[model samples]
Target: MVLLLRQRGRLTADTLARELEVSTRTVLRDIEALSSAGVPVYAERGRHGGFALLPGFQTELTGLNHEEALAVLTAGSRRGERVFGLGSALASAVRKVVDALPEGHRATASDAAQRLLIEPETDLLSRRPVTEEVPDTTMIEVRRAVLAGHRLRIHYAATGQPPQWRTVDPIGLVTVRDRGYLLARRSGEDRTYRLSRMLAAEELPEPAQRPNQVDLDQVWRERCAQFLSSDHIAVLVRVHPARREDLLSTAVAVRAEEPDADGWLRLEVTYQDLWHAEWALWQLGTSAEALTPQSLRTSLHHRATAVATRYGHQPESRHLLPS
Candidate 1:
């Protein structure tokens, strides 16, 4: 409430109540408590009157030592800053934290934070992290709505689909593997949307009817469980021992595995879908062979045949360039 008053200069009780999602009575009592606790809080009662903090009134976060301050800086430096669209606010907070630390410890904390690196452009294996791009305008409104417990409307376009407008009661926001998602409810059913897919967003004035408390991690786990159990394709394969890891990494589940007389590892696996199973098995090349599901074998054969025929001297299809 103090921060709100500091930002806006003055805010009416009704406005404060709406912004803080509490009753005006609670707001008034909290203001009283603040005043009793030696804060420079004051209220004006009349038309066009409201609560306002004294000019230049501010508060510092107390009791955080060097180590804790450094931890905050390092975490703020992470992909989360960009993922959650809190980069500017985090920068401001870090500045205040540095100002609060003792002058002697401030420089040390800053230098140490700079030395700790995470998710560098190129990892040790030369693999680069994939960054999903989300427009700042869209990300900011979505983040605001979720944090403020307000309804959100988005113009979103999912892969291979037309853009459509949707209104959801946003419950939480999540970032995983450098991608952002909004967890919400649409017409009473749970929905998850990729932040990068949001073309535009608007925060509605109406409050969201979400549960007061939520275990976001549990919700995410349940969603994952449902996805993994849906439309799975079971298959059997024979894989060379040397290339076993390549085969297992892409599979959703390993149903069974046994050694064959030919010194190969015969394994039964499940994949997310037929396409997933075929693509994963195809990636193994000659090192692994699909043993069941004739359809998979046929699809692989057709793909290989197309590749071979394309390279084999098919006459007219090849373009003849002028020498």
Candidate 2:
């Protein structure tokens, strides 16, 4: 019973019955046993109140050292996807566990939480809400496999391929720019698979081993730094504040800086990957101007020329812009 309380701040009779390997009737009997034996368990008759500890009941967790308390609190707060109900319940349960910990651990716990703040620079959901429904069960299963460090047998369909079943060891789950990805190690190869294309996944019993062959974070950082230091050209944009908000909200770039109170924002960005930036700029339309890097201006002009050629000559006497 005490262990159950520590694991979950509150347990209902049905939960206690399941945990104790007894029926609900037996659980009630046991409660009576504890009560008769001078324990202060109180069972309320109303809908909201079940069995609750008497008002002044005390426990050892209330005396934790700073580090210990912070560890508990930080773990609870780290459940960031609690945009739904489960996250809230999980967070609430974690808080109770932290609250129960001894006071000596509070400072250490707080410091750890501060040091480990994992704020994502970009969130896929922040751009807008998604109406497409993904099965909650599928998300749960994927999370379970990730937590266990196990390989999963998945049926996946890529854009140009038929659905096929493959075994993969998931390394990370990323939600970037309105898309969720499962970063996984492909079986029999050095490459990784993305989860969004997964059709189905079944967890295998065997655990996937982490490779000592690569320092993962260092590798990613090196790649990014290499791009920043390389011979790649930079592009500049002059943006109005209203447009700046849209750019900041949608674009992934190295730097965004506001130049003055004139509501003009200057951006210094590199296009390491070219597939998406042009489409993004087109979406921004007239609000954005390519300010510098004359090569880009030439390219844009050529593109505009090609577009006008495709549409034939404009009406000779009609002005396009409004008077």
Candidate 3:
């Protein structure tokens, strides 16, 4: 399962044998085993295709207790909120797990889970950790809209935006970490709405056609990849011995090198965009420096000045003398 997931494209009998450290005949037998176990294992006798699991073949979690079920749903919910593709799958799996929970503990556990208050770890740079619990009815409604290809008229609030009513064609429900999001199309744009921020949702009377313009999963993957790709402003930072963990925790797709004699570690990470990069540098306090992209240093210095001015003060005059 790990190999199938980690590897992309096609696989040959010999390739699978080498990867699994078994004979070619053994690889064929294992493929048969997967097939018999209802895995969509198929082989195409061509250069482009070989042994493969059918696309969208995933094990459903339908056998777990209330707490255990909640864990699975919550895990997927958080990740889906970040990457839109996994929302529908997570919702379906969560539903199955919820349905399978023992009757006596189901309702009580579900209610308790909904009321649970979670605090997001401040160490990461991903989307705000979804720690707030949304109502169960919202999840049900979102799922119904997604599966039935219905439009939803919802009142939603974005992080820095005012709340407003919008008509969205529900594509999938993404739950990242502690929050669920509705991935939908507005106008022609793909928009993600936090489930907790959705004040109200109702199925619209005017059922619209599901657009054939873009694949939701593909769009989600592209967005994530684009967001995490290394920035042009390659940065290196010396962490305060005390706050090294805090800095390391915020690096999403960065390479961190061993600390030098000074109690500071060097890291290689990209800024998603200028705004994101500036925000990250602020979080590092005096521990970070731009190893490249000289402009970032100037920008950070300017930002510091602006922020300090806000308090009727000037920034400290200790700019890292141009290295």
Each candidate's root-mean-square deviation in Å? 13.0, 9.0, 19.8
Candidate 3 local lDDT, residue 158: 76
Model 2, 139-207: lDDT tens digits are: 666766766788777788877999998777766554433345565667544433444566677878898
lDDT of 1 at 226: 71
Among the numbered candidates, top TM-score falls to 1
TM-score of candidate 3 on Cα atoms, chains taken together: 0.44
Question: Stretches of candidate 1 above 4 Å error?
Answer: 1-78, 232-272, 286-323
For each candidate, how many residue pairs have backbone atoms clashing (under 3 Å)? Answer: 0, 19, 8
1 or 2: which has the higher TM-score?
1
- Write the residue-wise lDDT of candidate 1 on 181-231 in tens digits: 899999999898999899999999999989999999899877766765678
Sorted on TM-score, best first, the list reads 1, 2, 3
Instruction: At residue 137, give the lDDT of candidate 1.
Output: 84
> Against the unseen true structure, what C-alpha lDDT does each candidate score?
0.81, 0.60, 0.63
Instruction: Name the runs in model 2 displaced over 4 angstroms.
Output: 1-52, 59-89, 101-149, 174-180, 187-194, 206-210, 213-216, 219-235, 252-263, 268-279, 282-286, 291-323
| TM-score for each candidate, following the candidate numbering | 0.60, 0.52, 0.44
